[model samples]
Every structure is written in structure tokens, then in C-alpha cells.
Target: MRRMIVLGLGALLFVFPFYYMFIGSLQAEPDTTVTSVLPDPGNLTLGNYAEINEKVNLGTSLLNSGIFTGGVIACTVVFGVLAGYALARLRFRGRGAVFGIVLLVQVVPFQLLLIPLYVLIVRGYGLADSHLGVILPFAINTTAVFVFRQFFLQLPNELFDAAHVDGAGELRVMWSVALPLVRPALLTVVLLTFIGPWNEFLWPFLITKQADMQPLAVSLANYISNVAGRAANPYGALLAGACVLAAPVIGLFIAFQRHFVSTDIGTGVKG
Candidate 1:
């Protein structure tokens, strides 16, 4: 009973920030003090949401974010799966060297290449203020490839052998045999990839100066930095923007969270 109480308290502690943010977003007046945690019911209103929406155009920013995040997730999954399969299953002359290079790339931060990437995408490709340009640099994620490769490696070799004996090509074997057992890896990669681009502001801001093309992160950032202070209820307006930006990610995680369980890959092979 004592342990249960402790655990419940811990859970509440973790959830309080989100609860506070939601409640704060509904307030009609700015309240930054601790006493305002239990504000009067009369002060609650949806005006803050309306105000932030009017400024940011929540619908358009959300759509832009969806497109950008969706594209990155798609490209990351496809290329990551192919590259991971090659590294884990295929035997080639330079496989070790290639894998080493991938690991090396991970040690380097994306910021280091930002200048060159900007020049290549904007100057060379002439894709300024475009969704494709924003999506292109993040298309192939090395982290996702590493994750898929690790998961693929955990599978028993007998499954691949059986597929090969049955005259299945590499692609067929991967699709029918290998891919089914890596559900956890796919979900993990999607969630991980989703958070990065969804929360990313710097790169997107640099890529597109057009307000219509900007993602929610960039828009909310600009609002919080420049416009929120001028609002009637600055605290509520800022929280409202945060809630709007966070809602989809929270929803996506909730929807897919149940499928994050590990599969028993060893069951396919008879002992």
C-alpha cells in the first residue's frame, strides 16, 4: 500500500506539467504566479487559442508540419530498411569498411554540415522555400539505419536460409520474412524520427523565410520570441501554441504505443 502511494505520487509529479500547461492555456488572463494554479473558473476562456490561431494560422502550420514530418519518416524508413538489410544480411567485399563509415558519420553533428547543406540545397538545387528542400537533407537518417541493422541482426539465420532455399530473392525474403519480425524497430525509428523534425526550428527557419512554408515549430518559436509578449494574455497564448505543436506528437505516440512490444523472433526457428 505504501509503495502504491509512492508510485501514484511519482506519476502525478510527472503529469503535473502537462496538466498545468493545459489548464493555463484555457485561462483568459496571464497568470505566472504559483497561486494561480487554481484560478477562478470565471477566468477560463478559449480566447488564447483563438488569438494564437489568428496570428499563426494553426491549420496551415499543422499541414506544413505534417507534410515535412511525413516525408522524412517515409524516406527514413525506406532507405533505412534497405541499408540496414544490406549491412546485416548481405556479404560483400567492403561491407565492414562501409559500416565503419556509417558509424563515423554518426559522431559528426548535423550543425557542422549546415552551411554546406544550405548552399547545396538553396544555391545548387535552387529549392529555396520548398517542402522538398526541407525534407531532402533529413531523408536518410543514419540512426534509423543503425537501429534497423541491430534489430535485423537479432533474427535467427534459419529464416533467411529457408527463404533462400525456397528460391526467394533478397527483396522477397526481406519483405516476407525479415520485415515482419522487426515491428519494434520500425515503431522506434518512426517515433524517434518524428520528434526531431517536428521539434526542429533552426534548419526549417533557415530554409524558408516565407510564413506559409514554415512548420509549427518555427511559427510557434517566432510567436513566443516576438509576438507572445504583445498578446492580451501572453502566458495563455504561449501555452496554447505549445499545446497545438505538441498535440499531434502526443496523439501519434498514444495511437502506436501498444504496438511497441518486442516480437519473439526466435520462435520462427525450431530448436
Candidate 2:
């Protein structure tokens, strides 16, 4: 009974926001107001969704997010794995220093780096307000490299040795042996990288001033601004927009939930 109650409460807490958003979205924009905490059920309508959809190019924002997220994941996987393997396996000068710097980089707050990065993108490279401008800096993730290195360090020497004996080169060994062995870590990196871009607000908001180039989070902010003094019906529509904006992330988590939830457990058990 205790477990049941806890589970029910947890489920309710998890579901409540989406439920409220849905309820808000269903009501007419005119009915959603500061005067009422809840929209009138009798006046529930999908018109808000239509209004929001008509105003914002949600499809473009979705595409931009997909591209940025995909690019970040691709860069992190390729570069992170290579750098991780080097740090884990290679014996060379400055290796420890490099790893130490990576640790230090992880400690540095992203907010601090924002100004320099923006200047570099806008003034230095002239990539201002471009998609590449926003994504390029985020491509190289220190934490991802660190995580991959830790997992790579735990790998036995015999695997590499066996591959080497079979005439496999470093690239071949990494491609065939190392990658397959660290599926959990790779998945974790991909998920984190994707999430960073998917829910990113500040960087996207700052970098992409143009409406069409903005990601969903930034677009949503502009959306709120547009509906600020509008009728209550627009509030319902705004809520609907919020739901649509959030759906992809929620769906992604739901789709890959098992992998994400079990990764830590699996790693702990294996260790």
C-alpha cells in the first residue's frame, strides 16, 4: 500500500503539468485569464492551437533543433570517442595535462563562456545569427569526452591486444571493438548532447535573432511575448503551443527511456 501510494503520487506529479497544459490548451483564449486559475470547460476549444500554429513556424523550429542536435551528437561521438581512446590508451607526454584541462573545462560554467563565444562567433568569424554559429562551439563537449574516457579506461588491454594481433589498426579496433563494447556510454552521450540542443534557451535565444532560425524554446518565449495582452483565448492557444513544443522531448525520452533508465543500473552492476 505504501509503494502503491508513492507510485500513484509520483505518477500524478509527473503527469500534472502536461494535464494542466492540455486543459489550458483546450479552453478558448478569451477564457484563460488572471481572473481564473482554470479555463471554463464549456468553452474548451482547439482554436488556440490553430492560432498559435498559424503565428509561429513550428515546423521550421523543429527542423532547426533536429539539425543542431544531430550535428552535436555526430561531432561528440566521433571526436569524443577518438579523444577518449587516446586519453585511455595512449602513453604520451601532456596526456595527463590534457585530461586535467578537460576536467577543468567541465568545472567552468557555460554562462561565463557565453560572452566570449558570442564575440568570437559574431565579430571574429562573422557567423553571427547563423546555425553553424550557434552549434560549432557546443560540438566539442568536455564532459562527454571525460565520461567516454572513464568507460574506455575500464576496458581490458586484451581486447586491443587481440585486435592488434589480428592486424587491426587503431581506427579499425576502435570502430569494431571499442565502440560495440561501450554502447551504454555512447547512448548516454547522444542523449545528453541531443537534450542540450533540444531544450537550449539562452544560446539559441541570443544567437538566432531571427524568428525562423530560432529553436522551439526561444520561439516559445517570443510566442508568450506575442500573446501577452491578448484575450484569454490566446492563453489557451499559448498553452497548446507549449504542449506542441514540448512533445518532441517528452516523446524522445519515452522512446529511449529504457535505455537511459537502465544505463546507470547496468554500469553499476557490471562494475
Candidate 3:
């Protein structure tokens, strides 16, 4: 009973922020005090959402976010899977060296490369003010590659050998035999990749200043910095913008949470 109480309290602790954000967004009047945690139902209103929408075109911003995030996720998955499969299943010279370099790259913080990346992407490549500019830098995620490699390594080698003996090519083996068994990894990489690009404001802000091209993160940042203070209900308006930004990520996680179970890859291999 004590353990159940503890777990329930922990769950409530994690859920409270989201609950408060939702309630605060609905508040007609700005409320920051603890008393506002449980505001009167009569004080609730949708005007905060309307106000933010008027200030920023939510649809356009959301669409831009989708395009940028979608492109990144697509590239990350494709490249990550191929690179991972090669590292795990294929014999090649300098494979260990290459994996070591991937690990090395992870140690370097992305912020350190910001200046050079901005110069090359914007000035050298002339991709400024374009969606490709924003998506290009984040296209090949090393972390996703590492995750895929680890998952692929967990699978039994017998599966690959069996597929090869059946006259299936490398691509065919990966597509037919290997890919189906790594559903959990695929979903994990997708969710991880989604969060980075979806909430990324700095890179997108650097890539494009065009209002229509700006993603929701950039718009929300600008709104909070410049316009939210001017709103009649600044607290509610800020929370409303946050709600809009967080909803998709929360929904995706909830939908896919049950599918993160580990696959019994060894079942295919006989003792």
C-alpha cells in the first residue's frame, strides 16, 4: 500500500505541470500564484488561444514545423538504418575506426559547430532562408545511427547468415529479415529524432527569418519574448503557446508508448 501510494504520488508529480499548463492556458485572467492552481470554473476561457493565434499564424508555423521535422526524421531513419546495418552485419576495413569516429562525434557539442555550420550552410551553400538549410544540418543524426547500430548488434548473426544462404542480397536481408525485428528501435529513433527538430529554435531561426518559413518553436519563442507580455493575460498566453507546442510530442509518445517492448531476436536462431 505504501509503494502504491508512492508510485501514485510520483505520477501525480509528473502530471501536475501539464495539468497546470492546460488549466493556466484556459484562465481568462493572468494567474501566477499557487491559488491559481485550482481556479474557479467561471474564470476559464479560450481567449488566450485566440489571442496567440491572432499574433502568430499557428497553421503556417505548424506546417513549417511538420515539413522541417518530417524531413529530418526521414533522413535520420534512412541513413541511420543503412549505416547501422553496415557496421553490424557487413565486414569491411576500418569498421571499428568508423564506429569509434561516430562515438567521437557525439562527444562534440553541436553548439561548438554552430559558427562554422552557419557559415558553410548560409554563405558557402547559399541555402539561407530555405527549409533545406534548416533541415540539412540536422539531417544525419549520429545518435540515431548509434542507437540503430546497437539494436542491430543485439540480433543473432544466424538470422543474417540464413537470409544470405537463401540468396537474398544485403538490401533484401535488411528490408525483409532485419527491419521487421527492430520495430522498437525504429519507434525509439523516430521519437528521439522528432523531439530535437520539433523543438529546435536556434538552427531554424538562423536559417530563415521569413515568418511563413519559421517553425512553431521559433514563433513561440518570439511570441514569449516580444508579444506575450503585451497580452491581457500574459501567463495564460504563454501557457497556451506551450500547450500548442507540446501537444503533438505528448500525443505521439502516448500512441507509441506501448510498442517499445524489446524484441526476442534470438528466437529465430536454433540452439
Considering only N, C-alpha and C atoms within 3 Å, which residue pairs clash in candidate 1?
Answer: none
lDDT of 3 at 41: 85
Please report, as a residue range, the 10-residue window in candidate 3 with the lowest summed lDDT.
262-271
Ranking by lDDT: 3, 1, 2
- In terms of lDDT, model 2 sits at 0.77
lDDT of 3 by residue, 1-271 (tens): 9999999999999999999999999999877777888877888999888888888889999999999999998998999999998998888999999899887876777778899999999999999889899999788888778778889999998998998899999889999999999888897777767878898888998887888889999988888888877777887778888899999988987887774444522111111
**Residue 47 C-alpha lDDT in model 2:** 85
lDDT of 2 at 264: 36
The deviation in Å at residue 1 for candidate 2 is 5.6
TM match of model 1 to true structure: 0.86
User: Could you tell me which 10 consecutive residues in candidate 1 have the lowest summed lDDT?
Assistant: 262-271
lDDT of 3 at 211: 82
lDDT of 1 by residue, 1-271 (tens): 9999999999999988988999899988777778777866988998989988999999999989999989998998999999999999999899999799878877777768899989999999998899999998888888777778989999999999999999999999999899999987787777767877887777898898788999999988888888877877888988999999988878877887774444422111111
Clashing pairs in 2: 28-233, 29-232, 29-233, 29-234, 30-232, 30-233
All candidates' TM-scores?
A: 0.86, 0.86, 0.86
Residue 2 lDDT (model 1): 100
